[model samples]
Target: MILHVANPIYDSVFKYIMSDERISKTILSALLKKEVVKVEMRPHEYVNTTRDTLSMFRIDFAATVREKDAEGEGFKDRVILIELQKTWLDTETLRFRQYLGAQYSNKINIRKDSPKGFAYPMVAVYLLGHRVGDIEEPVVYVNHDVFDYNGEVVEEGKEDPFVESLTHNSIIVQIPRLKGRVNNRLEKVLSVFDQSRKDAEDKQVLNIDENKYEDDADMMYMLHRLTAAAADSEMRQDMNVEDEYYKAIEDRDTAIMNRDKELKHKDEQLQQKSEQLQQKSEQLQQKSEQLQQKSEQLQQKSEQLQQKSEQLQQKSEQLQQKSEQLQQKSEQLQQKSEQLQQKSEQLNNIVKSLYSKGMNILQIAEITGINKDEVAAILN
Candidate 1:
């Protein structure tokens, strides 16, 4: 049998169905896979804006879970804090952080029995209307596993408050990936959210085979609730309002993206211009440094030439002094030569005078100390 049911992916439909305590318990049990002894909803604020209408529905459930003892003789009841968050289109990473941080910081999450006031163990469940990264799984569970230095897995104590309070295990359901892959009971339960099951004529309603979930009480109850929601005049009106609201949001987002792209292009042009100017400045600086080096080399060469000129001037002065000394010596030699010539002439005249006086050659020679042959020659 085919039944037309309201699509719970719609914020209004989701809020309508999950607001019921029995429905919340059934969904939690299916997602957590734990036997929930009891569930009590903690207080949370809700806003009715189209944008905020259960866009993020966060509630705390003080849930008591029944677990079998290791000895298998008894069941132990543990109270845990389940921080349930359901989000539609927008699943910002920071938004998840903000919600978790708020929950962790809230003082109401503490246990009343402990003297040190230890916090209750927290488990976070995120129902996303969108996919996360490249993960193709419809359901992703993130749990903290302990390891030793030797890379061996260590078993965590079942009731360790310190480790459990600080860290949490998380379950993420990517509603879009739920498609036709219903391999388990959990998957079958989640198949209702498969957007592929949406009715062709109306997006607000989904077409599902009622026989597939006839044996499951929880599943049937959910289907009946959604069917009622689909028939409600107020619920259908709210869904329409949501449809118009999302359409406007989509248009707004498109406009913003186009503006961002334009701004990015301008930024790139400015950045290119900045880089070009920087390159030119660097080139000019390099040229200036080369010129300064050349100027320093010229100064050094000028100093060398000045030193060489001063050395040549000293050598020229020494050569001038030597030339003057040579001239003085030549003048002294001329005076000596003249004096020798005068002595020679006087001696010759004395010899001639002796010869004219008729003095014997031998007497002249003796007086003048001249050789006899030279005295005779002069007299003749």
Candidate 2:
């Protein structure tokens, strides 16, 4: 039967074997029967006998048996070598042989001259998990002394005839075959190690009181610790993922804020340009109005200058007509002066006649005297 024991060191097969002490005691008690009182357990230890040796080996557990008295059917003192096997290594058989030899030679103290030969037999038991197939029964091999020649078996026992008859006991228990073999408390304990069962069923099997003893509390505590550690590790991984997610969101928000600020700056620049354009348009409108007013004033000034020029031209024509009339009047006055000179001449001739007809000298003198003097002067 296979039983699990709690192993804090987590050695693969040993951890499975050491999962529960009650299970361990039950299996060990059944194997050794009445000879075994308890099992001696220790952490796996490695010793280097040689400085240059790089090899290592471990002893899983040693059994302590009670001494037997001579009542013809009592318990015998003995020690069993227990091994938990998980992997199907090719060298396992040789390694198990080596372990048996070490246990036999290294553990027991011997005297060179003592007559009592070592009577305690070292048995090796392997509790295998899942590898051994089809063979439902436990495989048992007993080592015996045999004759060999050139690495070939020649005879049954020629070298050590005395001890050859007794069999060296070894047992290999395959865990896969325990499906329907045995019932009661032992089978329930074995169900926990069977991977074929559902997890809930396995938990139910572990909770069964008939399968466990009061001494299994320590194993339960160790299992709880392992479960808690696994849970904490998972929680830490989840937290790390959450932190990365939050950091990505923060980076995205920062990028969006920068883009918004850039857009706002561009909008402000556009607004300023629009305002400048409006101001320029207003200035152009004002200039256009001023130009229109100046054009109107220039048109009025041109009309006033044209009227003044027309008045000055009319005054010049009137002055030219008056100058022509003055020239004609002067010509007429010259003609009148010529006629008056002729009349004076005629008056002078008349006076000369009066003087020749012998008129009175005093009358002629009074009437024509002044005229005669003028007429004489003209004749001269």
In candidate 1, what are the lDDT values of residues 220-326, reduced to their tens digit?
99999999999999999989988887786677668657866875686566556556655655565555556555556666789876665555555555555554555
Provide the lowest-lDDT 10-residue window in model 2: 48-57
Off by over 4 Å in 1: 46-54, 156-158, 264-380
lDDT of 2 by residue, 1-380 (tens): 22332221223233334545543565555544434555766454332222111122244555666766456577676554454333222234664566556555553422233365533344556655445555755433445445456677655334232342133555565555664444544444344444343235222112222234345553355444434433454433533443454465556557657866875686566556556655655565555556555556656879875555455445544544444444445445444544654665566566655654555445565776564455444222
Best by lDDT: 1
> RMSD of each candidate?
45.5, 61.5
| CA lDDT, candidate 1, residue 356 | 52
Query: Which residue ranges in model 2 land beyond 4 Å of their true spot?
Result: 1-13, 16-23, 42-58, 66-92, 107-119, 131-134, 138-167, 184-191, 198-380
